[model samples]
Target chain A: MMQALVTCRGLTKVFGKGELAVHALDGVDLDIHRGDFATLAGPSGSGKTTLLNMIGALDKPTSGEVTIEGTPLSTMSKAALSELRLEKIGFIFQAYNLIPVLSALENVEFVLQLQHVGAAERRERATAALHEVGLAGMESRRPSAMSGGQQQRIAVARALVSRPSIVLADEPTANLDSTTTAELMELMSRLNRDNGITFVIGTHDPRVMAHSQRHIEMIDGKIESDTND
Target chain B: MNNFGILRTIAWRNLWRNPKRTLITLIVVTVGLWSILAFSMLLNAWAESSRQNALGLLIGQGQIHAAGYMDDPNIDHLMPPPDGALRDVLDSDGVAHWVARLQLPGVVQSEYKTLPITILGVDPAGEREISLVPDKIVEGRYLNGLDDDAVIIGANLAKRLKTTLGRRIILMSTGADGYLEEYSFDIVGIFDADQGFEDSYVFTGRSLLQEYMGLDDEIAQISFVLPDESGLPAMIDTLKAAAPDLDIRDWKQVSVMAAAMNSAMKSIIYIWLGIMIIMMSIGIINTQLMAVFERTQEFGLIRAIGLKPRMVLWLVTLESALLMAVGMVLGVILAVLTYFGFQGGLDLSGFSRAMEAIGSGQVLYPQFAPADFVIYPVLIWVIGVLVALWPAYRAQKISPVEAMRHAT
Candidate 1:
């Protein structure tokens, strides 16, 4: 039995007030264990992305708790959450988010730089991460110079370089073509299978669900089905 | 690089991303500082020239008169020459130079015309050290001695009297007995002074005037000049101790208008500088806020990547600081060049009449005190960084969630 890395109990998120309020998330209870490759599949306006954001500590829930490795996010300060994000979680965005000013290697090392990692060690780790993402000699190039696929790979390298326990990718393959999307899905699946790193991705694509070990379907902010179904 | 190194790298690279905007803002800062320094130097020199002009014309840095001579200048208001004790103090190191004169209101009559003037009876040797009029002899020689009896009148005075060098003139004044007396003297020198001085005063021998007035060495006043006016207060105190019965007055008291103008010029300079700084600060704030808006996603991305809001504030602040530093360097260089370029003096001869109206010279030589160089850079840099906090605070208040919306 795998240990639970993230546990959510009755999570809810509301936007606006009273008659005009919106329930972006409503009573979502779920568990993501270590070594599990999970996907929160839903249609547009569903609460999959909101649930992912709550787990990432990017947004707070209205009336629920998200426990990451047994520490409740409700009890953490904004500063402590920031430290937790730096040390315990990695994020890969759909738009291939990379600092335009920094080189690929520098972008990868940016989080480590904030973590107070020594220069030589951080450089070595960033270089290894870049190689693992299939971008061996492209370490010095900027994001603009790389193709969309290569840029997304650099984003993956940045996420993995920080050695976070879980990488929450929000629609990571939304912008990629079928060929590049297949390649990225396979790469992330390999990283999960070989390294036992947990991955919780949010998407509506059935192809993405096919690669995950656990599929939790959501509609109108509630889980409609899961691996148990 | 360390954390600060990362921030600096980002700031420097971010500044150059839009080179045109950065350059424009930098130019504003540069031009502002350059104008302040250059204009300050010019005004300082002009003020200095005004003070020197006020001190040189007739009022030395200070003067000594008989108890009531300042209020009324006549035979009845005369005082005896300095006694041994007073003379010793007047000869002290504090007194750079002193000249005793018998200045009286009188009339000079030439063959063709007659004009009213202040008759200044001066010792020629002592007068040269304290007065520029003696050295400003353009037509004839300065006075010779107390026994020479050769009068040196202003060039304009000579014109009004229809007189020239070697011409005979009769000077009439009241004697010690309250009776009118007169003497004939040769015009030996005609000095071309400033516009006002040229027609207002005439010079003669001290003892010769004393003889004509039937007084044995009684004089009206002694005028003193110091090497620098900075020591005037201390030296005036010493001079007062020596001549307790006589009246003493510093240049500011003797020339009230010049003193007031000096203060007014300084206030105007500070006010102008304040206005320029405010304008520059507005330009900086506007430029930086625009830069912040353009890099909104970049800031959001960093905040999501574990950079706290305060660090974002520092990052933006550092960017502004770098911009100001670049401008300050160029500004200081340009200001130095401007100062040296006008070192020979900025010619304002076209405004000569206006300058003369204010009793200043035609050329203004820009100068700076030692303190200006040290204080200006520190003050400008500190204030410049402080003004940038507005944009930095705006950057800090951005939410990390904006990163997802503006991920591109």
Candidate 2:
């Protein structure tokens, strides 16, 4: 009975129009509660990523509504949405999209810098975030100098540095090997348990699904089943 | 970190992301600005040379004459020497030097030839202060005093008249009684000057010419020089009020051709600047747009991480501004070095005939104006940043979703 941090009511997303129209999400409704480590799991064309993007406010729904803390996202301006994302939401991409020119520490501090954080506190929080993601001694390393797993860890550190209300990760482990994927999952689970940080991951991997407290299966632009462990 | 600090860090780092492109653009800006500064200075020197050559011929910075003297330089148009309010004004603070002369049309008869000429009756000491004719004596000597009773003619005129320094010549002009009066004087000096001046002018002592013309201290013109000519208008106004019957005119009115050339040179400078600005704008726009297009996904990634469109625009524009600023600094340094290289003046003696045609000296000295250092660089930078804004706007308009589709 935890209060919903994110709510989607009869959300729909269509990519095109007319006979060739592709419905990426059709009348989808969902709620993500606080402290819930959730995963949207499905096959390739199943609308899970689209639904995640809608929830993350990265894309608009064709109809219905998406709300974060009861504030409708459709009503916010682009700049307001950006501000909301900066203060409340974190993102980890499948490619580990870190700014190549920035050091690992700078990458972690970039969000706080955008929020106009003081230099000393931004450095302290970024260093601690990197340490929590097991990247303690690699603060000065650029993304190009690090391995795939190490880069993804830095991305995670960057995501968690600002202490956002929710983390939206789209196929975060899609480029990782089995050992690195299990390690990343364990790290996310520990963060979720200790810090009560909510996570919504989009993936087709069952190993990723096993770590989620709430597993939602999507098929053909619709939620086929929702199961909570 | 502060907002500008972070933006600057990213902008600086991004400038060097592709070193080759950055350096090439930097060179473009540097060379463009250097050429603008160098060529502008050269044009300025050319204009200044023309003005000096024209003014030094006979007109000083300004002149005073009887009301109708400029239209008709005869004995009837002469006025008494400066005194009263006119003398007080001429002797005031700003006037550097002034000389009164009785200039009249006449003919010179030498041993073998007779030719028409303009005769100038000058005070030897005063001419030394305000006249180039004093220094141009290539042979013999200038008249020592008002009572020397000698004359100096141009070398070319001496050649035409089959005469040389120390030879006697007969000067003839209409006297105060409206009849022809003739005076014979020994030729004490032969001077070399510009072709027109060499062919047309003769100089003698003012007292000797005045006595011969049956007048007492009468002068046809008063030519003066000021330390700085910016006060020429005010000085002219004061003199006009002081001597209402006398006409006071600045060198620009006295030397119409030189004034026109000066105006034309200034126009050419602005035309050249416009052309350079167009070329530099094209180079800047291409370089910045390429950088934006190359980093489309990176821009998207930042946007997804909560950077507003305006911030993206600012970051990109800042990058370009940094590039332009560094290039402008290097260009200014290069120009200053080039100017020092010509410390002795850029010699155009090899093109002496061409230089003489335009009334410039054999040596051209490049001058450094405040506009060269402050106005030009700041202008180029502001324009360069403005030109870069197109690419920044493109970066701002990049859709995060579309960019993410190109990810990995």
Candidate 3:
């Protein structure tokens, strides 16, 4: 049996208080195995992204607990959580968020720089990651100079350069065209299968759900369906 | 990247983000520092010139008079000679040059006009050694020998009396016994001294005044020049020990008006500096606050990426420091250019009389100690950083979520 890389038990996130209170996440329990490609599906206003944020340690759960590789995230210090994010988890955003001042290679190398890697080794790693995402000769191009899909590919290269244990992508193809979306999904799926890198993608896109090996659907801040493809 | 290196790069890049604003701020800072430098140098030059005029032209380094002569200097209170004991005291104190002077109130008459004036009787050769009298001869020549019976009259006094070089002037005054005494002097030189009073006075040999007044061995006062003004106290002690009855006065005592003018000029410079500091502080505070407002999302992103609250505060403070340093560098460059370009010479077409009254020449030359340039910019930099604290604190207090949600 594959070891569970992430486990959540009765996790709840509440915002504000009293009459203005919002239950962004309620009692979400899940186990995600190592090397799994999972898609979290939900309609707008559902808690799918919130759950992913919690699992990514971008936010905290108000109740219950979450553990990554048996280290409980709720008990971790902010510095420890930052270390976890830097060393173990990588993130890709739907908006293809890249520091406008940096070139594609520099954007990918930022994580390695933060990890205090040597400049030459960081460049080598960043180059390899960009090549793996099919952006080998475009390392010098800035995000604004690239297409949406190309920019998103650079974002993926940035996510994978540090060789993190899990890649959390939030609606990674929401802005790409159909052909570009297919190419991206295929690239991500290939990296997952070949490198044994786990992917936890939060999206409502049917295309994403259809391609994933496992799918979890959420509605009104609760899990509506959990299915294995 | 290393923290400080990253901070420096960001700061350098940030300066170009709003070039117009930065340029405007730099201009204000540069002009402000320039004004301070120019004003300080002008005032310093004025003070230096005034000191030189009073000490070199009129009072020398120190003066000696009858005990009550400062309050009422009358011919009856003339100093008695030979002042050998006082001369020995001044010599022991390392005074460079000493001269005895007899001051008498007289009516100086030329061919056409007569004017009331104070006649200064000096040892012609000793006067040249102790004062600027020899250099101030605008026409003819300075009095060379006591036996020649020649006098150097002020240019204005000679003009008033309608006298020329080699002309004769009659000097009449009351003697020590209150009887009218009269004498005639051959006018050989005329002096200006760039001062109104000095330009209106007359100078003759000391023995001539004593012989005319019928007090052959009497003197009005003794004056000496010292190398350093700081040595006045020791010099005064020596004079007191040598001649206990003779009163000694330093240049400071003789130039009260000059001292007051110097004090007022200094006060005005400090007040101007205070106002510039306040204005610069306001400008810097406003710039930092605007920066905070504009970079809110970027700051939020960094905070969310794991920078501590204190780090954010340090970042903002460092940014402010960097900005001030840039501004200060530009300001100092501008000030130095103006200072050296002016070559210490400032055209005083505007305040010529004020300059003249303070005994400075027409062109105001700014003089400043080296510390003034180095210390003031650093002080302004620190003040700029201190004023940036409000914006830095505000940045630190901003929550990541709130900061991300708000638009710039």
Candidate 4:
């Protein structure tokens, strides 16, 4: 009965047309509630990543609608969508996309700065965000100087610093080892519990599935099953 | 952080990511600008010396002649010496120095050769202040008095005539009576002027020539030298009103070749500017475009993090502005040092013959104008920013999809 932070109804995505047509997503319905730590687990070429991108407002769906907090994405301009992404959503990629030239602290502060936060508050919030993710002493180090787990932690800090409504992570632990993956998932699960920030992760890792409150199985371009913990 | 501050920080950091590329582009911009500055100074030095050399050759800064004197050089086209109100005008502060000369086309025969030349009948006292003939005496001495009856000719002319100092020569010209007048004169001085002037002119005292041609108190022209050319127009107007019967002309009008040379030099400078702008514009476009293309993923990352496309454009432009500033500073410093290297003057003595052909002297002192400093830097910044816009536009077109990729 909790309010849905994101709603995907009969969503479909097609990459090409005619004989060369490829369906990246099929008709699917899903609801992501506030504070839900969910995972869309499937093998490669499934529609889980496409679904994540649709809900993140990063790409458009071919049919059906994606509504974030009752605002339909189809009606927004590119600028409005970008503003929505800045204000409402956070993203973590498997590759850990951080600006190489920026320090870990600067990476964390990047979103807050985009939100036009003041320098004093931006630094304070970014410092606290890094500390919350157990990266307190590594704030000034660049991504190249940090390990895969540390860089993912910095990415997590960057995502959570602005207190976005939903965090859409696409295979965020693909590059990490089992120990680091469990540690990162536990840190994210704790943040999800404490901050009430919803998480929608797309992955096939059982370790990731074990930590989620809900798990949806995807095959090809459609959702095959949905289950709750 | 403020919006521009954030943008500037990223832009500044982006430049040093590839230090070699940045330094190479910096050197290109620096050398391009420095060449414009240093070459302009060198050209200006040569132009200034050529103008001085042209002005010194008997045609001071301005001149006054009888209404038809320049049209015909005989005694029939002569004007009365400066007197009455005209004398007072010449004595004013506006006129630095003035000399009366009865210039006539005549023949000089040294027994071995006969050459046609223009004879300048000068006042020794006045010529000392305003004429090259008085100061260019390489042998013997200048004419001493109005009745001295001695002539000064260039060393080249003396060699042509097989004549030397103290040698007697026949100076013949048309008299006031419309008959041939012949006078004997001693070669008092052999003056050495530039190549062109050296071979065509001979100088004698005004009174001696006046008496010899049977025309007393009549002169062909009165040349005046001013402190500078800025007051030349006003001085011309003042003389026109004071001496309506006489024709007044500026040195530019009297020496048409020098005027043409000045105009041609200005055109060449504009051509140099055109060439520099085209070359530098292409250089900036390529360098800035390469820098933009190399950071496509980074651009996309910033854009995905809520940076607007226009802001990406601004970020790229900021990077170019920084490069321009560094280049301009380096260029000005290098140009100033290069100018100082010519402190003693850029000696063209090795090319003395070539220098004389164009009327410039052997030694040239290079100096820059204040406008060169202000104009060159401003031009570089404006042109650089404009030329960098294509790359910035490409940066703005980076899609958010690129942000998903790993850095290269």
- Runs of candidate 2 with Cα error greater than 4 angstroms are B71-75, B91-94, B105-117, B139-190, B199-217, B227-234, B339-344
Q: What is the TM-score of each candidate against the true structure?
A: 0.90, 0.89, 0.80, 0.92
Cα error of candidate 3 at position B73, Å: 5.5
- CAPRI classification of candidate 1: medium
Better of 1 and 4 by DockQ: 1
Between candidates 2 and 3, name the one with more favorable TM-score. 2
> Alpha carbon lDDT of residue A225, candidate 1?
92
RMSD of each: 3.2, 3.3, 4.7, 2.6
User: Residue A200 of candidate 2: its Cα lDDT?
Assistant: 96
Error of 2 at B317 (Å): 1.7
- lDDT string, candidate 4, B220-336, tens digits: 989998877799999898899889988899989888988888888777777887787787778778888898777777776677667777888999999998988899999989989
Candidate 2 local lDDT, B23-97, one digit each (tens) = 988998999888888888889888998788778868999999998988888998988889999999899888999
**What TM-score does prediction 4 earn?**
0.92
Worst 10 residues of 3 chain B by lDDT: B399-408
Q: By lDDT, who's the top model here?
A: 2
lDDT (CA) for every model shown? Answer: 0.86, 0.89, 0.79, 0.86
Model 3: CA > 4 A from native: A1-4, A7-10, A60-66, A69-84, A140-144, B63-96, B103-119, B129-205, B208-250, B344-354, B405-408
Highest TM-score among the candidates is held by which one? 4
Q: What is the TM-score of chain A alone in each candidate?
A: 0.97, 0.98, 0.96, 0.97
